[model samples]
Target: MEYPGGTREGGLPRVLSDPARLAALEASGMIGSAPEQVFDDLTRLAVSVTGAAISAITFVGETRTYWKSVPHLPYTGVENWQNGVGESFCYFAVGADGPFIVEDAAKDPRTAGHQAIGPWGVGAWAGFPIVTTDGHAIGTMCVIDAGPRQWKPQELETLAVLARAVGNEINLRISLSTAQRALSTAQSALAVSQDLARSLQDSLLPPVLRPVPGLDAAARYLPATGDVEVVGDFYDLFHTRGPWWTALMGDVCGKGTEAAKVTALARYTLRADAGDHLSPAEVLDRLNTAMLAQRAPRYLTAVQATFRATPAGAAGRLCLAGHPPALIRRAGGRVQQAGVPGSLLGIMPTIRLTDVRFRLAPGDLLFLYTDGACEARADPHSPLPHRPIFDEEALAQALADTHGLDAAATNTHIAEVLAGHHGGWASDDTALLSLRVPPNP
Candidate 1:
């Protein structure tokens, strides 16, 4: 069979034959793996976003293509679940090590005569490579349509993000397996486990907050001490569209892989819905629905703020579900609470979420955090029999004290205050996000 790009000669891409790439694929252990809920959730999400008839997580091997998860198609056995390497479009993504999209498979030169098109009834296809940490293309998270249709840019971008999520999941399992093996030779298995925990936790969150035009933003994540398991605290700040931006913080109910999966789903759903909805309540409502539909392993509480910079300052809506209220610092150094109390997510069929409108004048700032900040307590090892918790009143006082500080400074000061209370050993994971309007010249 002929390949698409000239990068390959007559047969498949050289990457398919590369020993290292093949080794990474084998180590993934997903070649003939049974269907799992996590992958199923992702494929379902892909279909929902792309409006496709079928969505799949496919891994291409040297001789065959394996379908790990296909929400529309049930898995019977390994022999019945795979096809020859040249029989599917998955190799196009693997060979090019990138996305392979075709609005019309029958007309596109790359896939005109593809063997799977007729049997699969694929009128259109869009796939993104699931690459490992070491840069090996393992498989793809793709959507397939029964009739020809043009895909939108946003839909494709979301697909790419989901593909990376699949890659992260695979790499996490690989890392855990390596850590388990290291237990025999390593002097301290605990240290190796902690490193693995931190890595997995980091993947669930954004490394740094993205800048929003006319708004000052800063964020920080503090992990609980002495815990080798991954926690579920996460925060993100991003632009939704022209002039609009969103900032959110959430804490899931459990730890380890279960909580991680829920966190990933929440973040992905939040991003996908935020673009279409302007109200924070609507965005989070959609998230709650998605969580329930996906059968999320853990329930979570989240606070989201969606706002756009105005000529006078910044104005937008803030919503909270089964979480603490958001704190706002006025230019006069007065700190006050915002957000209406509502239901937590993924626990019940019905929920009540309210979006409260808010505005920030020049020199004013808005702050969001997990319960860890206000619930902080002295180290358990301390001599004091009764430890005092850093309650909401104390948090408000700390925020008010940073009257003239910028967004970054405000977050730094609050983090320092929390550390002082906990003695640098937090009991629960803490996430902090702040957005401040610049003072007028």
Candidate 2:
């Protein structure tokens, strides 16, 4: 075949003037891009195979020859290995039909006066064209030595194979970049959806707890640890009417959207029925009825308490619905569990909860909590297959230890202890409500 740009005397190669080849090189989208590590690795491999002082993957562009990778080259305070198109040996290699080798650039007529010989100190050189799938040569994979050396035929073949491998790496990198961008776009969309779900879940619970006269009350609701998913644990303390105030805490079965729905339904029903002046047990029964009507595939355990002022102090009635027992800490540091037994709600049509009536003297504390507190592991970091449970016995001991602490301090202390026991992350959701009757004024 005839050459696009005719060869010079002694068959010295020149840049091709074929527009089709130039267009293919321009369409590759690799020119003037940031250097890639994959190309750097290929160049290093070429250096190892040829035992040369310098190895580079070069792209021959219209105006300049760019070194995509030159692993062993020292920094010269310049941008990169870039030179005028005709000044580098890669220019001739890109135009050659096959591998091009010059045993000594100083004596070879083809490269004797080349600019690469004087300042670059290139004595011996070997290069192979990096051809594209469409039969267009875009660049070269090259090795250079500072001293004259003859390249064996097998060495020439190895360089040819390395050149093809470099081509494959470039294509792989482009495909990988495209995939990473697509993954980033999908992750952004998922984050937006999770934020919306969290907001909606927050709206379903009480915004803030109101203070009740003559009582120091504090409550906490902790979601399950780790990923941000909607949990079913909730607590609220609000006044019904007149001198009566009601407080409720519950945990629904399951997680995510379905459990969240049941949690919202149960909270609204309890608040709506509080104004009827019903007993603590009656209110929970009403909640059970409403839950059964919805027929949601979830169940929950709950504790409800109604407080009213008495001559000696505040008196209250506690009702349990398949939930953990409430604890009563006397002014004298005696801890007693309410120990009311009942069945879970939402599962049975006619559910009944036991009501345990008790009076709180000045300096007395009433503590209500969910099963998460009892089932917590004693040593979360233990390597043993099973860890000890932080059951009611341990909890009662903790309460007894905090004898004279007020409502807020007591709750904070309990929370800290629970966090310590669980390695600062609760495996399940936790809810705690503390009600303290102040001393007589």
Give the alpha-carbon lDDT of every model: 0.89, 0.81
Q: Write the per-residue lDDT of candidate 1 for residues 1-441, one digit (tens) a residue.
A: 343334444467767777888899999989888889999999999989989999999998877899999878767888889888878788888888889888999988878887889988889999999999999998988899988899999999999999999999999999988877786657476678778878888888888778888889999887787767888899988889889999989999989989989999999999999999999888888988999899998999999999999999999999999999999999999999999998899988789999999999999999999999999998888775666799999999999999999999998999999998888778888889899999998
Candidate 2, 47-131: lDDT as tens digits: 8888989888888876677777777765453356677776778877776757889999999887888877876679999999888
In model 1, the number of clashes is: 0
Candidate 1 wrong stretches, greater than 4 Å: 1-192
Candidate 2 wrong stretches, greater than 4 Å = 1-30, 33-157, 167-207, 222-225, 379-387, 423-425
Best by TM-score: 2
